[model samples]
Target: MKKFRKIGVAAVGVLTLTALVSGCGTANTTNSTPSSSAPVPTGNAGTTGKLEIFSWWTGVASSKALKALIHVFNEKYPHVQVINEAVAGGAGSNAHAVLASRMTNNNPPGTFQVHAGNGSLYSWVQAGDLDSLNNLYQSQGWLNKYPKSLLNLITFNGNIYAVPVDMQRANVLWYNPSIFKKYNLTPPTTFSQFFQDAKVLKAHGITPLALANHGNWETTLLFSDVLLGTVGYTDYNKLLHGQMSWNSPGVVQAANTFTKMMQYTNSDASALHWQQADQLVANGQAAMNVMGDWAQGYFKTTLNLTPGKDFGWAPTPGTQGVFSVVSDVFALPSKLSASQKAVALNFLKVLGSAEGQKVFNPLKGTFSPRLDANPSDYDAYSQAAMKSYQKDQLTLCIGQGAVNPGFTTAFENAMAIFVTNHNTKQFIQSIENAAQTNPLS
Candidate 1:
């Protein structure tokens, strides 16, 4: 959510924005070049070297999960040393900046964490900085192992560019069951019910929604959830694809709902990090929080809380049939030495393998990207998420990776403005301008 200068082409004119607002797809397409063939090295080709993997998983649960996965990788090839260059803050904002700088300077890591959609992955692809994984998928027979929707997110022009480690459900509404039971309330399934519950919770001196906006993406994330609830799946996807406008009536309503919902949130929300916000709900200081399932790892591993008893979860209001997804994936950089490439490919293999996913996601509070992953290996919460993922209408999450990075940054700035001013019209206008300046297509 740090204000970032727009980095992509700014060819989308105001007229294009207006047309998109009217639900016309007339904008120019910025298609990526199809990936060329690259030789797929078998059995690592006797590779023995250091593999530097970069990511923002420095938290206790995430770091431990990465280490566990690395341990598994080492067991397969003990000669390779894995350097986990994790930079953590602002839910990957700091890491992203560092990675961008590294990429700009031509000092890329062997593999780096990127969101699975058009945001980070497509930016790298458009810049011609990524190595296609199509050969890798073919060599490993992974074409049928993963869900087609997931593969489509990381693939472009018939080329796969990244290996997704795990899938996170971004539209979860987590609540303290004890507080809900005390109030004789059940999890709300609609925004009307949500507002009614918020009023009751506020009357009893409980913050209705726990929010941490110190990282501006959290604000954007909340708005994205509301937008999905307001516009539903089809239009939300259109919005992300630059076929719909930010200034549309649905977006205005979503922004208005976001502003109204903020009224019941903790006053100190802007000063807290996401973990602190989750703590507010965990300690029963707040009744509920809308976040990805990673909060389950914090509550379970860090806070030592039981899942079903200490906290409960439901889909965000009006989003029961939708799955807003955020996946952490590792993409190979175009620049790599032969040995580094071999080790990197091996590392990706580990990431995409069933054993790695089974060991990693259970501890990380997410589910495997693969459809064939063993459900019994995950916890009750993750099992439910995996089931929902299979059955729900999938949509890309903005903060996670659904749109272009330039557009994502612009939308974050709009959210920052909306959070301070609470002007719904201005908020809509700001995002419309953002879309005009930073077109996704």
Candidate 2:
């Protein structure tokens, strides 16, 4: 998917058109938000068959969410068995690769979890390796609930591709509440103030930003947040679209800001995955971690801490308000039995249905994509995300969301080298060199 705000108009236009072709052409904008206004649950048809589901989810809460959805799917199809095939490691490389291999071997799962957007999963769907969910989507009236902005990401060539399971609000700052109390520091609302607070925390021997750059993508998070905060969304998009060169002053500034964060982070951040870094904050070894809502699930399932009392959530303090997102979506794989296809489509509908979103998204510690879904009882940090989303002011991560997988890596690689070496000049050149030129009409 092209991250909405990342690439400039050219890339954005290309992606938007690509989506219109793949996810479905123009999405209708007259839909109402899926709030409490939804109709009372009425009986939907049930199935009595079996289908296998596969995803890269390995966390307890992740599994719980998937299982809950499966349970609901079973309520309709009591005899239908939803088999789960999940494995860990390599940031979904292993699971995705296995699924790709399976596709060739003729044993692909009925449905598979994937990242949202036309840039990532569109190829497989376009290859006729996945089933079109357009018929099912329209039959169930999902368009009226999910909205064109959200649903359009899954729509392609006038056909919908997948059901989004969860939306991760990226670039959030989760701070330890107690640590703030100890230092008498309130979470600052601006980047400048935030940095000042970080200096204070550093004086007292605290790592202000929970950073682990091992997977390398973690560094991309910091760069994305900085670019969004400093350069403004327009230039950030241009940078990703290759309209603006990496040698621009904005990239230079964002890189410097990232270097400042490194100074305040744990020295071991180089070896940490985002999870391990979050653990540092949960365990009080660190004061903050800038990540997405998924970390909220990690804290709940792994550390078992209360959100508001233990930690406070804040967005990457940049302009008045801006948002960043990453969503977990599932596409129907090709080569499904008729019943399996039915099950897959039915499962997707359930995923977006009011109940499916409520049970699954909350458990996953993510916000529901359905517009009207309330994040009732969500911990403090997550509600902060809702505030951002509702404002429609969030910016998407440029490199990851705007660039394709191949190009996304090029950006990540440039960021990793920059973060480690703290080299502004070299980093700017690297990004300029790595960005793939894409022109739009």
Candidate 3:
């Protein structure tokens, strides 16, 4: 784990160098035990102060959902001015660079959104830049509120560092219903079926898969889905944890499958971001897209398309029984003053509460991290997703910080090259090289 610290520092240093060289354009890169339930101190509620939150969810659905959550928080703590310092970028690419700079300069935000996994939390913990929420969890009774499996991912060295607000299934295959019907195609449940549908769609002049490689992380995300679908959840987890070799036959097969899938994507994929790729599907230019469930929000809210009617969804091929988890959480930085800590913890309390989750997840196109969130509040897609989540084997989304940030970036770089070259051997070797530098062991 100490190696993870070096990886974090080195990655931040690289970002600093890039910013210095390139003039800092929207740069892209990519805790604790708690006590029993207790009353939160509100002596400072009358004091007026600002709470700055940093995140990359500046899109319509995410931004709207966040604002709703903030509105609820503001109602209770009216004196505290909540400043949303959201950076616009796909998968925290730009926001991360800004955060790294802020942390490096000793000017961290009150609390910022982070992935609830080893990749994100471990790096900060290793750097000694984050405070634990063990006591907070104990006080809030959240130890038992969330799933033990989920709690395990956020917990490190017996401390809970962040409060998970929502969970997004990353292995979702979303498609235009009209497009599928026009071609007489059913939603694919197997890779063979996917290839078959892709052939049909291509012959009819439709892009089989909508992919965006502009952010680089989108490509890695697509690869993660393909890898999971090809290798299955167990081996995929093994690969992510370094228990399985990157050069293994399963990984090689997954890489080959990824290459094959890339063939069906739009030629302009490299020019677009994830949202643009999704638009290809939404507007009926493409047949399908593999993305997190957040696309559901974009379709419903931004595009005004109804789920199960305008669009449809299914688990990615060979992943019907698996749930690829990408949870969004908020963590407190260690540099907060006593007053800031109190306000930050209060904000986290709302974020972790069932009330806050119910208000946020439905609008965000995701399910709540809390097990007890009412299913009636969500839409048809989220309701089905929540049901699947209850029974499916859960796996971490490596592209979304389930591993290590340095390794994630390395894998994304390899994927970026693979997208253009389609060189399987080089892709596999690049992954192996990345694993060597940041061993999961």
In candidate 1, the residue pairs with backbone N, CA or C atoms under 3 Å apart (3 or more residues apart, or in different chains) clash, namely: none
The sequence of per-residue lDDT tens digits that candidate 3 reaches over residues 86-113 is 9987678788889989999999998998
lDDT of 2 by residue, 272-384 (tens): 88889988888788888887778899888677888788767877777446676677888777576656766666777788788888888777888786666776746666676
Best by lDDT: 1
Off by over 4 Å in 1: 1-30, 43-46
lDDT of 2 at 389: 67
Model 2 lDDT, residue 2, Cα: 32
Q: What is candidate 3's CA lDDT for residue 373?
A: 75
Number of the top-ranking candidate, with TM-score as the measure? 1
Comparing candidate 2 with candidate 3, which one achieves the higher TM-score?
3
lDDT of each: 0.82, 0.69, 0.80
lDDT of 1 at 353: 93
List candidate 2 stretches off by more than 4 Å.
Answer: 1-49, 399-402, 437-441
Q: Rank the candidates by TM-score, best first.
A: 1, 3, 2
